[model samples]
Target: MASEPPDAAAASRRDGGRPGGLRRMLRRLTASEAEIEAEELQRDVERHGCQPARQVERGQLVSVTGRLRTVVYTPRTTVPTLEADLYDGSDVVTLVWLGRRQIAGIEPGRALTARGRVAIRDDRKVIYNPYYELEAAP
Candidate 1:
């Protein structure tokens, strides 16, 4: 197969940035259902004080599932966080975006299954963290 033009890959990324179609596929292939579920249990994971990894030391490494709410990509800034609204028949959870390395596409209300540990951030329950980190995207 012919290799893509040198600029071809760069062009696609330039067109959609890092959070493009490719990112979404990677997230889908990596995230787990339990991870998403654990995310739903967060207590305002967005807040810096929630501290998922620190507070929830014994978080279970589960496979969670959820739906994307939004994805903001800023190459000039730092890692992209994939904001999402995750749910599990039991309840609806607001999943905060993870680091850029783990984040992927911005599905915006799309379903996802993530794999990670249960933790807390700013007094809230979270799936991913440095210690018991949560892999929301990929």
Candidate 2:
């Protein structure tokens, strides 16, 4: 890897001021040029339109705008799970907060945002179910 110049205004910088950090990482990841170009185009397009995100025929980005209708906390389990009933106004999503790092942070009725890939669990659609959690409202 080569060193990049110290000019902060030059553009995005990575590594030792080298040009290859982003490109090399992209190359190593085997990202397609068209995909990269599309991403760049998407970045430009992002400022002009609503954000694009992963959605189930059922789910959307877990944001603070959702309503909190339920919460369950277990105390006897080896690892606690914070189960939340998140409503996106139209319907509800059941999100599970697993692991001490996240499960410890959940609270009932707190406005939250959780972003993750959505999937069908127990035949119902959920986002951040096994992966999502209660994100503190900023």
Q: Highest TM-score, which number?
A: 2
For 1-138, candidate 1 gives per-residue lDDT tens digits of 887677667656755755465665455558796654544534334322333333334366654444444444434355555444444433433355456434434356555555556555665445542222333543
lDDT (Cα, tens digit) per residue for candidate 2, span 1-138: 776565542435444546666565656469775565445434532443423322334455433224356778655457676667655433456676654334544566554555555556787656554443444565
Best by lDDT: 2
TM-score of each: 0.36, 0.41
Error of 2 at 54 (Å): 13
lDDT of each: 0.47, 0.51
Q: What does each candidate score in C-alpha RMSD?
A: 16.8, 14.2
